[model samples]
Target: MSELGIEYQTVLGLPPVEFVHLAADLDCHHISMKVTGGGIYHHPAFSMLDDTALRQQFIAALRDRDVTISLGEGFVVRPAYELRDEAAALDVMAELGVTRVNTVTMDPDLPRSFDQFAIFTEMASDRGMTTTMEFAKSLTVTDLPTALQAVAHVGRPDFALLVDTMHAARSGNGPDDLLMLEPEWVGYIQLSDDTLAQRNPVYRDDSSDRRVPGAGEMPLVEMIAALPPVPVIGVEAPMRSLLAADTPVSECARQAVAGAREVLQAADELRETRARGCHR
Candidate 1:
């Protein structure tokens, strides 16, 4: 199985320093750090007075730990606004030598304007960064088919799907959902759980329900079995869940690692079972 990672938002509300330290301690291979708007570029620690310095510092941080960043969760809300930021961000990414990004859209009800998405997609490609779209239950590209449609429409190498465990479970996406995604369209997989409730509620509240991968009721094993070869698996359990019982960063990181192992083991078991059934 591939190594696991944690989204920046998943770590019990710890500061970046604590979170990164705990992730390294837990033996995580990478971390999904968000750089939306001006967060990373404008921050005091990562303060980049201009585009050049911003990109330089960003690369230095990643290189320091040899960690790869998976950015973008709610960045597509205002594409024009976000794309402009992405242009500056990509400039840094190109100079720093980063490779991929993960982003989610705010508007899930209507078709994307394409003007904004296309702009960023093109920019990322030019900079050699792969831009993957995360499918939220509330996004225009809600399901696998719709997301695939959008990817097909954009037809850009950087424009692909970044599957979220929370959205996939909330939307009741099954193995079929994984089957529908073209192998190339899949960029990275964010794994979490809706395990708070055994029987899904009528209104499955994602915020309250998000948990570590194996801890939740998501069909993670089945989903992983169907996923194409992916480079990263992100553990992005909700912040509250990490602190709901006053868990420490170290404990949360341990849980994250345990949860990932459970999911991967389950996936292997399911695959073996299916192979047996197919032969019989």
Candidate 2:
């Protein structure tokens, strides 16, 4: 099984420093760090760049655990968006050796958003990071084909797409859509499941209500099979119900890893069975 990553939302209330420790304790190979945005945006933290000492401590902890800061979150580009003092976030990312940054577009103008994405990817590349565009049913870039089109327009090697399983299904995409994606265009994938049969009327809540892989009706095994060989899989199930029940973050992380591994194992077994059948 690939090293499963835990995205920040799964343990939303935890401080960034403590979050890293939980991930390390869970033996997570990678973690998606959230440096900015909060409240309705779902991320509940500010810049980890404020305190140099704290940042160093965080880095040391990750290093000791051999965990990679595989992804960074909360970089958004929209019309009339001004690049504020992003130096803090960039500095922290550099120190942590983060490789990929997540971006979302809220601007209604598709053409303008493409130009903005180009600028964002250029900035991320300058800091030795790749920019990954995460498409959702709620976002302007709603599906894989549109995401591919946007990436094509940007024409940057460092720009890639993030396929979040729940969002893919909500956006009316399926395994065939995954097949259509050029492996090079995909950077990594977020694995999760949702019980909703269709897109929610208020899509914002979807982030908090996700289920651990294989806990719901999502065709997770098939989705895994459709992915490229050895894809970097980030388990991003943020079950608010569990959180309300006062469940330990460690337990949540543990269940997420087990569920994801189960999906992968089932997919592998099915593939082997098929291979044996073909030989017969």
Off by over 4 Å in 2: 37-46, 83-87, 198-201, 271-280
Residue-level lDDT tens digits of model 1 in 200-222:
34332445336667766777888
Q: Candidate 2 lDDT, tens digit per residue, 129-214? A: 98889998789899888998988998988888888888887778887678677777888888888874754467777567778889
Q: Quick one: best lDDT, which candidate? A: 2
> Which lDDT value does model 2 have at 125?
84
Clash counts per candidate, in order, are: 5, 0
The TM-score of candidate 2 is 0.90
**lDDT for model 2, on a 0 to 1 scale?**
0.78
| Backbone clashes counted, model 1 | 5
What is the TM-score of each predicted model, taking all chains together?
A: 0.79, 0.90
Question: What does each candidate score in C-alpha RMSD?
Answer: 4.4, 2.7
